[model samples]
Target: MGNLDKDILEKIDDWLSSSYDEETRASVQKLIDDQAETELIDSFYKDLEFGTGGLRGIMGVGSNRMNKYTIGKATQGLSNYLIKQFPNQEIKVAVSYDSRNNSQSFGQLVAQVFAANGIKVYLFNELRPTPMLSFAIRHFGCKSGVMLTASHNPKEYNGYKAYWNDGSQLTAPHDKNVIDEVNAIASVKDIRFEGNTQNIIPVGEEIDPIYIEANKALSIHPEAVQAQKDLKIVYSPIHGTGITIVPKMLASWGFENVTVVTEQATPDGNFPTVIYPNPEEEDAMALAKKKGEEIDADLVLATDPDADRVGIAVKNSQGQFQLLNGNQIGSLLIYYVLSAKSDLKQLGNNPYIVKTIVTSNLQADIANHYHVAHYETLTGFKYIGELMTKLGDSAQYLAGGEESYGYLVGDLVRDKDAPNSCAFLAEMTAYFKSKGKTVYEVLLDIYQEFGCYQEKLISLTKKGKAGAEEIQAMMAGLRQNLPTTLGGIEVKEIRDYELSQTTDMKTGRKSEITLPKSDVLQFITVDGDVISARPSGTEPKIKFYCSVKGTLHDKSDYLSLQNTLEEKVDRMMKDIVG
Candidate 1:
């Protein structure tokens, strides 16, 4: 305790004296007696902030951790904000949890807090996908919702995603206001722990069918699905929530030959199969890939713990299984949706699609080809959902996705829906199979039409408080000393999202960037290469996204051109990030 900071010691003392539970106090005392300086500092250095998305952190007995007390405080604050926002009206909220270690308990605590505060609660009986939680918000006419899952984070971490009435995460004023409310609670005693059993309701059986039916309705080619019903598809949930609904949705979509990777079929918080349950990682999909190889499957799909994002593997030109990046998958999904809508004459006026700023520009080109308007938002899926709500009736939302293996079709749910994406992916595979082609073949065809766009994301992880400062300093250094040239190409323009301005390097003319202010910088080169530098909002890392475009006159030139682009990206990353 002598080595600990004076302020941190005081905070620990407060926790010991406060109305915290006996277990929490004992844990705090043990840390103090054991002189666990690092753990003490990390756990109580600062309060776990309720950011725009909500709280996420390692689970422990600390103010900065995800625990019963922290969860209760967040819920009570949300309860207060809801009552203020919806005065006199009956306030309703839905709660759902993933297969994380204490996600179910935290979710129940959140529901109890809402119920204790006189707000009606509709809680899922078991683990469900995060998108279904979003769907339940609208399905049950609830004013808000909470999803308990760390979403692709490691086993030690957990999170809470707060949703609004429109089935989207909180944005703008609500996000800030909720943060304010959460910060106002001074002590644990301020939280209401007792739940009103009458106000708390169990909701799964009735909501599941409606949600599955909604996803099933998004299918465009029922005939193609019937014709290619035996399309061999391998799927794994990676011991997450996807197992609850993915197979059921696929089967309902007429996929008769779906094979589940039984080893990873059960939902487990420990994620026993992989290092990270994220579908984006190749190692996480190894089991599913093995299953696919055994069955000679047409496609392999895997979803993260919350089932909000999906990663896919398909046979390449050499007949070897290759994992398609998020951009490739998003481009294919949008392309399929747009082309099918056009073929069916469903391209109504004001047809639009959405993608994040870091996503591939190929989506914009595809939207242009089909004459559909495309919008780019900030990095989070909530921003896409916010755009959907803002465009309520004036524009038709065909589909939207990000470069993080998340896609949504027909705007049924405001958040990313992996189960829905899986269904549509299989359907798209079936449709292509009817044409004697594979999804990979369709992707190559797309590149052949629109210039091949290659994108790479390099993330540098920096852990602990010092790492956070290092990340900030890195961003600051780049901002202060802007790069004039990258990979021997002249930097044509610089878009400083934090400053909300774009400066032309040659002309020195400045123009305002109309997007919301964020800590991101983009360098546009004369050769049409775009390099974006932004720190991850949810993780302890900074990411550099590089995209290069080149003409693919012939399919044979694909590999050579891809190699050239990759070399260029490596050079650019070294020049800028180093």
Candidate 2:
């Protein structure tokens, strides 16, 4: 009791006295009754800040955690904003969730809150991918949408992702405006907890077919798929919502030899297979990779819990299964989609593509080779979705991706889509197989054509109050003391995204960055190396992205050249943060 802070005690008391259910209230009271100071402080330290994207944290009964009350408040606030924004409208919203511990319950809570506020809700009947929620919003012409997921976070974590009518997450004025509204709900009494069952419509069976049908039309090479229909394909959902649709998406594209990793196929919030359910982690995709080896599969794919991002493994030149980093997968996806379409002389008018600034520049090079317009958005897929909506009717979107294994194809969904990516990726593999090539060979060819591009991401997680402060201090130190050189290359330019300014190191000339403000820093070397450091918006971590270039005139030099670039990038990162 002595260690518990005064403010934390007050917050705990509020929850205890509020209309929270007996279990929830008892959970909160137990901490106080047992004199659990540290646990109590951690839970009640501060209200989980609903960031630009939405709420995410450990699930528990406290202000600083993800619980029914916090999610309900966010829903009530979003409902208020929707009603105000679309006056005299039906005010429909799409609600879906992943298989996280409380995702289904949280999704129900969201539907109930929205329904209580006189908003029509189309909720998923079962766990579904995050992208499907985006698709539902567009298909139903809803005013907004919310998905209950933490993407690839750990088992204890859950989150909320809010989307706009255009099928994209909130951007610009809307993001800040929604934050304002969420903050305006100063008390639990202000939230509408009771739900109107009439207003909550269970949806999914009708939407899945439409989503699968829409994804099938994105295939650029049906003949190739037909020719190589027996392509060995292995995939795992990592116990997320991907199993619900990925296989169907693949089958819809004419893939006949698809194998599912049975052990990791079920939708379990506990994510018992791997420590972190993220496909980005090798252990998480281990089952799929092993299955690929057992069958000597042509390719292997795994999606995160929400199925918006995918991780893939292909046979390298050595005939061994190798996992493709996000950059490589995204680059190949763009290359195959654009090249196949461009080669067939089907380049549509105003063809456009997108990637995050931290992603590989090879994507931009590929876009340029086909004379397609490309734009670099800030780090989030929401920004890409926002740009797509901004360029509506004027520019046709071909594809867009980030380095974090998230990619979207066509204009079907406004978010990064894994199920859609799986369909296209399998199709891309089939097309390559039809050409007597492997996915790795095409990647090497792309490197041979566009020079070898290598990029690496390193994230440092600092948790809780002290960790947050340490992250801020590290950024401040780096900002105040800019490195003169990294990886033995001269620093040519430094871009401060927070200040929206890019300054040339030599001439000391500063240019304006047109994108919105963000806390990011980039240092470009004279030798075509762009190293960026930015903090994660969702998780408590800082990510360092190192992109380097080298010549790959000979395919035999792929492994050595790649290793050299990796060490160089390591040295470059070492100079800055280590």
In candidate 1, how many Å is residue 514 off?
A: 1.5
State residue 437's C-alpha deviation in candidate 2, in Å.
Answer: 0.6
Cα RMSD (angstroms) for every candidate in the order listed: 1.0, 1.1
What TM-score, computed on C-alpha atoms, does each candidate reach? 0.99, 0.99
Question: What does the lDDT come to for candidate 2?
Answer: 0.92
Per-residue alpha-carbon lDDT of model 2 for 1-578, expressed as tens digits?
88777898788888888467889999987887888877788788888887899998988889989998899889888988999999998999999999999899999999999999999999999999999999999999999999999999999899999999999999989999998999999898889989889999999577888999988887788998999999999999999999999998888888999999999999999999888998889898889999999999999999999999999999887889999899999999999989999999877989989999999999999999999999999999999999999899888999989999999989998999999999999999988888889999999999999989988889999987667789999999999999979978899999999999999999999999999999999999999799999989998899999999999989999989999999999999999879
> Residue 235 lDDT in model 2?
94
Worst 10 residues of 1 by lDDT: 1-10
What is the TM-score (0 to 1) of candidate 1? 0.99
Over the stretch 284-350, how does candidate 1's per-residue lDDT look in tens digits?
Answer: 9999998888999999999999999999999989988999999999999999999999999997879
| lDDT of every model, 2 decimals | 0.93, 0.92
